[model samples]
Target: MSTAQLVSLTLAMLAGAVTLLGLVIVTGRALHRRRTRRDARLAADFRPLLLELTGGDDDIDEPLRRLAALDRRRWRAVEPSAISLLTKVSGHAHAALVSLFAQRGLARAALRDLDRFGAVRRATAAHVLGLMGHTEAAPALAGLLSDRSPEVRAVAARALGQIGAAEAADPLLASLAAGGGVPFHLVAQSLIRLGPGARPALAKALYHPEAAVRAVAAEVLGLTGAVETARVLIGVLAGDPSGEVRVRTARSLGRLGTPVCLEALIHATGPAHPHAVRVEAATALGDLGSPRAVPALCDLLGDPQYHVAHNAARSLARLGSGPAMAVLAETVAERPGTTAAGHAWEALAVLDLQAGQLRRPPTAPVS
Candidate 1:
């Protein structure tokens, strides 16, 4: 064949391929739109029945049994909206939804999907089981902590947290140690969800070799408000070699708001501590809202780190101490148009407003 003929054939083939691809794209979009409309209609149809189920209205057993009898595709269309109501309802309504989930064997289905190849599938399954609040699913969720995918691990951790199972605590801590890109904050939140039940495991984690683990543990403990953990956090602030851990500890101590924690926070603001630690300590001291921290906060107002100095000045003002107000006034006068000066002025305004509130007389009640 001639070169021109060959080129013409190739161009025609390429044009056909592109046209076919466009057709496929359009078809897929059409199917998706149809599916979305169907799901929306199903959701609307189910909304009243689900609301009645959650409302604890009479004769729900037949309606619930009818719902459970729905075909797979129809139920799939309704499931997302149904589960979404779990977060919206509470008390009898919540229990009824949980019963619905159980009766439909959703927990079992999700438990089976926990080991699915797709990360999205596994994550979705974990979420459903977690929201179901089924303790029987905890073991499966715990196993997903070691999943190869970081996203899967994170989702599983969150699921375990929502379950708030004491047994899941150790596995979650162990995952933190393994550290395959699972965020410290996510792990901390999960531990926090377990409340005091997770305290022992988190306390042990504070002694882990990795500073990240220790920091997470301290932060979670503070969030839990486990009063007994304050002493451990104070020790970390005083002696943990990692400045990051110390910073986290200082912050945790502020959340704990114990008298000893106040002492540790004051010591942390001292010049001997690292800049980051001191900055955290300054911020934490503010969180404590203690008059005792004023002198230490005043001293930190001249820190070399502008943030530390600014935070110290701001905290002092929040403390509403006479000493703090004087320090703020001095800072505003000494440095103009700087962060420290700005925080000082802001702090002064806050302090004055607080002072006004304190001095305001109680209004007489109408007879």
Candidate 2:
């Protein structure tokens, strides 16, 4: 063929391919819309029956049987909304939903999906199983924590948490120990969802061989505000070799707010402690709102770490005594244009606001 004819032919083929791609995209979008509408209609039809089932007054065996008769597509639409209500309701209502899931074999179906090669499929399966809150699915979900997919592992941890079975605690902790891609924060959240039942395991974790595990355990215990673990946490703060663990322990100790916790925090703020530990300790003392912390917090204002000085100033504002106020004023005057000065000025304002003195403090130029 001539050169001009060859060029023209190539251009025609490119145009055809672009047209085909556009057609496929449009067709896919149209199908998605149709599926969404169908799902919405099915959800509306099931809403009333699901609400009635949640009331738990009537015999639900018949309703559950009827629900189980739904085709897979319709059941998929209804299950998400059902689980949404299940999460909000407890007692008989929650039990009714679990019974419904069992009658429909949803948990079994989810378990089968856990073995699927697809990541999204495995994650969704883990979510559904978790929502069912059935103990039978816990082992399968626990196994997924070792899956190659990070997304799948995270979802499985969440599912284990939602199940709230104490048996899942050790498995979850093991996953943390194995050091897969699963984030410590997600694992910590899962443990928190297990409630007080997980406290003993978490306390044991405070002494885990991995410093990360011990640090996370301290953080989770503090969030739980379980006073029973305060002594253990104080010990960790005082002696744990890991500076990160000591920092987390200091924060948790502040959340605990016991007399012993206060004492431990005061010791942590000492110059001998690591800078990170001292910073968190000073911050926690402010959170405790104890007048006894005033002296220690004041001493922290001259800490070499700017963060420690800033936090100490803020805590003094929280304490709101004449001595604390005097320290803030001095820091603001002596360290003008520095971060410490800014913190001191802000602390004075916070004190004024709390005292119903809303007038703006005299401005100093910040460098």
- Best prediction by lDDT: 2
- Weakest 10 consecutive residues, lDDT, candidate 2? 358-367
* Cα shift from native, residue 207, model 2 (Å): 2.3
Model 2 CA deviation exceeding 4 Å by range:
1-36, 55-65, 71-77, 320-345, 354-356, 359-367
How many backbone overlaps does candidate 1 show? 0
Can you write out model 2's per-residue Cα lDDT over 12-37, one digit (the tens) per residue?
99999999999999999999999999
The TM-scores of all predictions, comma-separated, are 0.83, 0.81
C-alpha lDDT (0 to 100) for residue 142 of candidate 2: 88
Residue lDDT tens for model 1, 275-320: 9998888999988888888778766665678889878877786676
Question: What lDDT does candidate 2 reach at residue 172?
Answer: 80
lDDT of 2 at 247: 94
